[model samples]
Target: MAQQLAQGGLTGAAKLKAVTDLINSLTQDLSTSSLGPRERDAALDELKVYARDPRNADPIFVKEGIETLSKHAFDGSSATTSRNALRCLANCLLVKPSTRNIFVDLGYPEKASIKLTTAGVEDEFLISRIIFLTTYGTSVNLQNLIDQHHLADAILQNLTRHVKLWTGSSGSSFKAASQDPMTDMALTETAKLLFNVTHFCRQKVDSFTPAIALIVTLICQHALPQPKPLDPPLGSLVNALLTLNLASEQGAAALFPKANPAALCERLIQVLDKAVRSYPDRELDTAVLPLITALRKIYELAPAEGVQRVMQAKLLPTTKDRKKVLGKGQSLASLILRHTTNAMAPEFSKAVSHMLFELSDKDATKFVQNVGYGFASGFLFQNNVPVPESVQESFQASEGGRQRAVNAITGQFIDKETAPELPEMTDEEKEREAERLFVLFERLKSTGVMNVENPVARAAREGHLGRDVIDGKDRVEELD
Candidate 1:
C-alpha cells in the first residue's frame, strides 16, 4: 500500500502539535535571561526557522518570540546571533505587514536610527531595509528622523564612504572587481532608504545636497562597467539621483567638473547605450526611463565641454557617415536617432527627442544641423516647432570641414553618386583625352619599357591626335 497522510515521524496533527510545542519551549527560553548565551542563541535559531514557514509563522510571534528576535537583532557582541536575528525579522516583516506595526510599537525605529548612525556594512543593509519598510503603513514620524536622529547626515556619511571607496580616496579596493560584496549591498540598501526619505521629505531635500555630489561620483564610476538594467548599486544609485535635484550647484559641479567632465558625461552615455540596446519597451519603462530622465537632467545642467562630448558621441555625423543614411549606420549616433522615433516607447521616445532638441542647443537650425532634418522633423512639427528657414543653408559645412550633403530625408546631404557608365565625349573632348594618354605613354617610354607606344605620336601618324599639345589651362582649353 502507498504511504498515507499523518503516517510517519511528525506527520499531520502530530507534527503541527510538535512544532507548536517547540515554539512554546523556545519562546519561553528566549524570553528569560536564565539561559546561557549559547543556549539562548540555539533556541532563537530553531524558532527563527519556524517563523520563516507561513504555517508556523504566527505561533512564534504571539508572545516573547518577537521580543527575543528584536533583542538579539541588536546584539553587538555576537555577529552570528545578530545576523540570524535580523534575517528572522526581515522575513517576518516581509511575510506580514502587520509585523511592521508591532516592530514600530516596539519603538525600534529610534534604536535603528541610533544604530544606523554607526552601523557597519551588514548592519547598514539590514537596518536600512527595516527602517525603510517602516516608512510605509506605520506611525513612524519621518520628521523626527530628520531633526532628532541626524538621519540625513548619517546617510550622507555612509554614501561618502562608498564614493571614497569608488574614487580611491579611501579603501584599498578601489575598483569594482575588488569591492567587498557586503559593502556593495550596504550601499544599495542605504541608497533605497535615501530615496524613501527624500521622497517622503521633499521640502527638506536641501539637507541632502552634499549627498548629491557623492552619488554622482559613484554613479559616474559605476556606469563605466555597463551594469545590468536593474543591477543593485547602479540601479538604486540612479533612483537616488532621480529624487534629488541635479540642478543643485554641488551636483552640477560633480557632473560637469572642470578636471574631466567627460568622465561623468561619457560614462552616462555608456549606461544609456547599454540600456537601449539591452531591454525592450516593457522593461525599459522601469529599467530605462529613470536613467533617461536622470541623464537628461544632467545634460540640462552640463557645461560646454560636457555637452560637446555628448554631441560628438551621439549627434554629430562624421565624413565617413555621409555615404550611408544617418540612422541607418551602426554608429552610436545612429542608434540614438533611431530610438528617438521609436513608437513603442513613447515616454522614452519623447524624453530622448526633447533631450536631443536640448542638445541641439534648442534651435531648429542647430537641431537640423546636428541630428539631420530627417530625424528632427517629426519631433519638431509635432511640438509645433518650426524648422528654421536657413536649415538648408546651414547644411553646407565649410570647405575642409567634412563631406557634403546626404539625402535630406536621410538627414543631410544627397551625394551626387558616380554613374554606372561613362558618358560619350565630344570629338574635341576625345582629342584632349587622346593627348593626355600620349603624354602618359611618352613618360612610360622614357622609363625604358620596350613595348611602350606614344599614343599621341601614333595617333598623329594615324591622323587621330589633337592638333595641339597638352599644357596649362589656357592651352588645354584651346586644345579642347
Candidate 2:
C-alpha cells in the first residue's frame, strides 16, 4: 500500500495524509519487534513512500522521517529510504515561488535561498546529505550538490580526509583484504565535488580568496600521500589571485588602510613576483592576462595613481622572468621601446619596457610590432593612458589599438576651446575633413575600440549598464 502511494501515481494531499496515518500506526504497532530482513524491507518501503510524497511533507513529518531513516542508514535496504526523504524535504522547501517568497520576506536573501528553502541550512539535513552521498550511492552526486550550495570548502574537507584514508593507511589494509567498493565510491565522489567547486569559484574574483584558501588547505592535508590531483586546485588558486580587480581600489582602501593610493597594485605586484619565482609555467600562463585585465580596470578608474603604483611596484619583473614570460629567445627591449612610445602614464609606459627587456632580440622586433602595438592600443591608447608618441607611429602599428585609445580619450574629449572658430572654409576642405573623420570612426568600430565608460560592452552584456552607470554618467557628464 505504501509502495503504490509513494510511487507518485497517487500524490494528492488526501492520499498522502492517509499514508502518513498508516505509517504512524505501523510504527506504534511494530515498535518493539525485530523484524526479519524481508519484514524490515517492508517497513522501510512504507517510510520511503511517506517520505517521498510532497503533500505528506512538513517540517514536522520530514524531520521525523530523517530520524527514522538514520536508524538503518548503513543498511543496504535503507539507502534509498534516506535519499528519498532528503529529496522530498528539499521539494517541500522549494514547493513554490510563493513559498520561497515567504522565506525571503522573513529576511533570507536570494543567495541563501538553498538554506531558506530547506529551513535546513542550520539543521542536520545539509551535513547528513553530505554524509549519505559520501558513504553510499543515493542516486544524487555529492560534488554537484556542493557546487550548487556554494559549499566548496565543506566538500573539500570531506574529500581530502576520505582520499587520505583510502590511499594511505587503509590502502594496505584494504588491498590485502579486498577493496571496499563503498569506501572507494565515497572517495571518488568527494574528488569530483572538489574539482567542481574549484571550477565554479574560478569565474569570479569575489569568490577567489575563500576558494584558494580552502583548496590550499585541502591540498596541504593530502599533499604527502596524493600529489597527482593537486594541479587543478593549485592552478585555479593562482588564477584567482591574478584576476583580482584593481578597479576596486577604493573599496580595497577601506579594507587595507596602510596601503597607499597604489596599495592594491603593490600587493598584486608582490603576488605576481612570488608566483613567478616559486610557481610553475602553467600557472603563470593561465593567470597573467586575467590579472593584467583586472589592473587595467583599476587604472581606468584612476590612471595617474594606478599607473604610478603599478610602475613603483616594479611588477614586470627582471629581464630573466620576462624572458620566461615572453617565451623562447624573444627580444624584450625593443618590444618595450615600441609599445610604450605612445603610453598615457610615463611610469606604466616605462614599466612595460622591463617586460620587453626580458625578451630576446630576435623576437623583439615582432613582439614590439605586434604584442607591443596591441598593449598600447588596448591599454594605453584605447584606454586613454594618453598618446605621447607621434600620432602616425601609434596608429600604424595597431590601427585598431590606436582608434580604441583615441575613443577612450575622446569619451571625455571636450574640445577645450569654447567652440571652433566660425571661419568659412572651401567646400572641398569640409568634404575632406568629413571623410577623414569617417575613416577614424570606422576604424574604432572595426577594432572594438571602447571608452572608460564601455556603453557598447555594457549594452551587449547587461542590456543596460544598470542604474549606477546610467545615473552616474548623466550626473558626471553634466559638470563638463
Candidate 3:
C-alpha cells in the first residue's frame, strides 16, 4: 500500500494528503469494533510499517496513529493485537522527538504501565520499549513518567519477576533454561528503566527494598565463584550495581539491612577481591567503579558495626593463600589506592579516593600508615575534590597534629597549624621588606632564575609591595 501510494501520480501536497488519508483509514479500521482480530492486527502491522518510514512520521498522522494504537494496546481481548499496536506506537515514537511528546501527551506511559501488569513475553518486550522511550526520552518525559505514571513500581515489578525466574530452580536445568537471550534482554532493559526512574523517585525506590535486595542477591550469586556462562551476563550485573548505587546515593540504606554486617561486608569485599585479582585480564574494570561506589555508599549509611565490618574485609591479607586470593602484594585497599592514584578517568580516581577516605575515617591510623598521609593530603589539595567531614575530623584527631594540620592546609609537612596567627607588622618594616623582596624578584627575573610567566613567582614578588598591606599579611600567614 505504501509502495502504491508512492507510485501514484500524486505530487507535493497531494502525495502527503494521500498518505494521510491512508493512515486515517488504517487507524479507523484499528479502532472499529466491527473489524475482527486478524483484520485489526493486520491494520496495526501496516501502521507499524508506515510509522517506521521517516517520511510518514508526520505529527498529524503519528498523533492519530498513537491514539488508535494506545486504545488497542490496552485492549484485554487479544494480547497479540495489543502487542502489535504497542510495537506500532513504539515505532512511531522512535521516529521523531515530536512524536515522543505526542506519546507522552496521549499518556502512553500510563497505558503501557497498565499493560505491563500481565503482559506476555512479546507484549512485555514491546512495552519495555515504550517504557525505555519514556524513561530516557528526556528529563521532562522521564519526570512525567515517574510523577504521573508511577513508573517505578511497574519497573520494579518487572525486575522482580525476572530476578525470581533467574534465581528459582537453581540446578543445571534452571541454568540451561534461564540462559535465554530474550529473557536477559528483558531483565536488562527493566533494570535500566528502574535505574533511570529511581534517579527521580528515590522515596518510591526505598519502598521497593525487596526487589532491590533481589538484584543484589543476583549480583552476589553471579559474582561469586560459580560456573561458565553467567546467565544474565556481566553487563546486567553492572547495571544492577549502578541502580543500587543510585538508590543508596538517594538515601536508601545498605544492600542488606537485616543481614549480619560482618558477613555482608565479607561477601561484598569478596566480589571486589575477585574482580581485582582478575583485573586488566577479565575486563572487570568497568564493573569495579560502580561496585566500589555502591560499597562505599552502603558503608556510609550502615551502622558503626557495618563500617567496622568493611574495614575488616578491606584489611591486608596475612596468610599465604589469603594474599594469593587477591594476587601477590594486592590487598583490596592497595588495589583501590592504585586506581585512586593512576586511573585514566578522573571520576574513577575521585570515587576511589572518597571510598578510601571513608574507610580511613573508620580506622584512620591504619589507612594513614598504609595509604600514607601524602595520599590523604593530595586528596585534600586536588581541585574541587570534597574531603568528607569524617575524614577531616579523623585527620584533625590523628597523632601528627601540627604537621598534619599544615599538610591539610598546604599539602606539605610543616610544624605549623593550618591558620597560624601572624605578628602585627609596622608600616615602616612592611615597606622595607617590600622593597627588599621587590629587588630580589627583579634580580631573579634578570638572571632567569624564575619563570617570568609563573603566577606563584609573580604573587610572591607582589605579595610584599601590593597596595593592600593585608595581602602581605595574608602571604605571611600562608608562610606560617
Best by TM-score: 1
Q: If both were scored by lDDT, which would come out higher, candidate 1 or candidate 2?
A: 1
- Stretches of candidate 3 off by over 4 Å are 1-22, 33-56, 59-61, 136-153, 169-173, 222-254, 257-288, 303-307, 310-312, 315-334, 362-365, 373-377, 383-480
lDDT on C-alpha atoms for all candidate structures: 0.70, 0.38, 0.56
List model 1 lDDT by residue over 260-301, tens digit each: 776766666777777777777766666777777776777667
For candidate 3, the lDDT comes to 0.56
Taking the tens digit of each residue's C-alpha lDDT, what string does model 2 give over 1-480? 564454435555755665666445434434654555455556555544544444554422444443343334322244444344344333433332223333223322222223322231222233333332332222333343344654544443444444345346445443531244444333333344344433443443343233333332332332221232223332333333333432354334422334345555454444444443443334433333333444444444444445544543353222332222222222332233333543333444444443443221223333333333333344443344444444224222123233222112111112221343566655566455545544554566567544233333443366443333333342211111
Ranking by TM-score: 1, 3, 2
Q: Tell me, by lDDT, which candidate is best.
A: 1
Root-mean-square deviation (CA) per prediction: 14.0, 19.1, 12.5
Cα lDDT tens digits, model 3, 38-94, are: 876776675566555656346334577567667777743787877777777677666
* TM-score between model 2 and native: 0.31
